[model samples]
Target: MKRQLHSCALAALTLLSTLPAGAQHAEPVPSEQRVTVQGMKNASAWFKAESQHFVVYSDTSRASVFQLLNNLERLDYLLRLYTSAYGKPQPLESKLTLTFHKRPGALAQFADTPPRDAVGLYSSCSAGVQGAGVLLAPITELANAELSKAPVND
Candidate 1:
């Protein structure tokens, strides 16, 4: 009887070891749809800001994008300064269109800060366009506000 019991216990232990110890779980894969918005002139980088998150898109290399995203908090401060200097606070509902362009081998253009007139709308020719680094914050803030106010189901 003792021998039979010992063998049964060993078999049970082996069976348990062969089977999964517990429920298996897998981590969710991250989303792949990365949005890119191009900056003006020498900047020539795509900027995507979603829910306070920002990324720079570069066809040449990803380093630029990673740099921008990592320094977003500082960039937000710069944006507020630009908006205060050039733009008036309007209703959040105001829709503004922005265009991005790249200047070859001219990263200095971004540092120089193109005149407001040079960054105008594609169609209007008179409307001013601000740098992506400058405009992303207010737009993101307003978007977040709108989202929070939206109705939710329990």
Candidate 2:
């Protein structure tokens, strides 16, 4: 009787271990995914790091310039509203600048410019917002929209 009990316990343990090996956990869905925007001409966009300042850049086309500026304003409002709702009032520190470049390589050349300390501020503020757990969904949605607007490469 003692031997049979020990064997049963061992078998149960073995079965439990084997079950996990064959039955995998479901894969997690990604929270953020890339979004591609078509018909964006002369427009290349990226986020620049400046503490609490979100600067978007494009190759200085009239339409692209306006679109980026408008987007920044909207983003600013969203950030403010979300942060306030969390009982943390943190304002954006950086302004959006639109520089016009006459040619193709202009945006790349501008990208090489040394980043300012504002990047740190932006990161810290973002961390605080995330820590408060108030900005994730809206920010994720915004990021997805921005990415979808980006050009897709083959």
Candidate 3:
């Protein structure tokens, strides 16, 4: 997991380096930077970590989960920079929910129409107030890969 996070950060930095020198820092608001982590009511013993744009629920260790989330934030920053420059920036109406499941088929249970042998799943409800965007991932499945190949699973 550390290797994956390291590679993700390195890739993000590499992308950042390619940006023009005048790039502005994409800092989260002070209030949004505050993080709250807690255990959820589930058989999987899920932990919830919420920040500015994402709310992650995982069965992984706190340190590793935070590391994964940090990479996600970095990607969001890059996306925002790109959208602001080349397209209409559509700010999120609510935080996106990301859940990492340890078991292979666990993620399918959350889907309205479960996939056939899916490694992960994503669902979004456009009519919902928050848009209800969610990403479900199989952490154990992805963890088997080497650093260079790790992100390909994502």
Candidate 4:
């Protein structure tokens, strides 16, 4: 899993390098400077749980957190079985933190807004070169906002 993240970051950098330098905003920022969310808590003031894999940061009930973790464990197990080049398994090298919002619309926004029905995301990052990251929406609220602006059907 750690390998995959680095590979992804490297691949993205390579691709970005190919684009015209003028079109791409390539400002070299130090990793420490790029991390704004690091100091901030991922979950809200309510309902937080810390584990080896993640810190469940949200107001979600413990029951929901357990259910979510069960799903994540299943995913991790599947990911470990995933074969890369030469048939190597992609195991996670680090613990990941997850923050859940009760209302989908309450989730964070990105450069490209997420879908209203987005359930969750594995990760997120700033536009920094090093690919420092964190993970997962108020898309549902945005969706409702957009729907309110839609033209009424006959």
Evaluate all candidate structures by whole-model CA lDDT and list the values in order.
Answer: 0.43, 0.42, 0.62, 0.52
- Per-residue lDDT of candidate 3, residues 1-154 (tens digit): 9999999999999998895789798987654232344574434455678877888776656666676677667668867887886777556557777776566567556776666666556666775222122234422323323544756443
lDDT (10s digit) by residue, model 1, range 53-93: 33333332234344444445555656777888687755542
lDDT of 2 at 83: 83
122, model 3: CA deviation in Å? 1.5
Which digits, one per residue and each the tens of the lDDT, describe model 2 over residues 12-111? 9889887445777899986422334587554343322222343433223334444444555666777677887676653654443333333433334434
The collision pairs in model 3 are none
Q: In candidate 3, where is summed lDDT lowest over 10 consecutive residues?
A: 129-138
Off by over 4 Å in 4: 1-45, 84-92, 108-112, 124-154
TM-scores, all candidates, are 0.29, 0.27, 0.48, 0.42
Q: How accurate is candidate 3 locally (lDDT)?
A: 0.62
TM-score for candidate 3, residues paired by index: 0.48
Those runs of model 2 whose alpha carbons end farther than 4 Å from true positions after fitting are 1-59, 86-94, 98-154
Task: List all candidate RMSDs to the true structure.
Answer: 14.7, 18.8, 22.1, 26.4
Displacement of residue 27 (Cα, Å) in model 2 is 64
TM-score of 4: 0.42
In model 2, where is the ten-residue run with the lowest total lDDT?
Answer: 130-139
- C-alpha lDDT of candidate 4 relative to the true structure: 0.52
Residue 18 alpha-carbon offset, candidate 4, angstroms: 89
Model 4: per-residue Cα lDDT at residue 22: 66
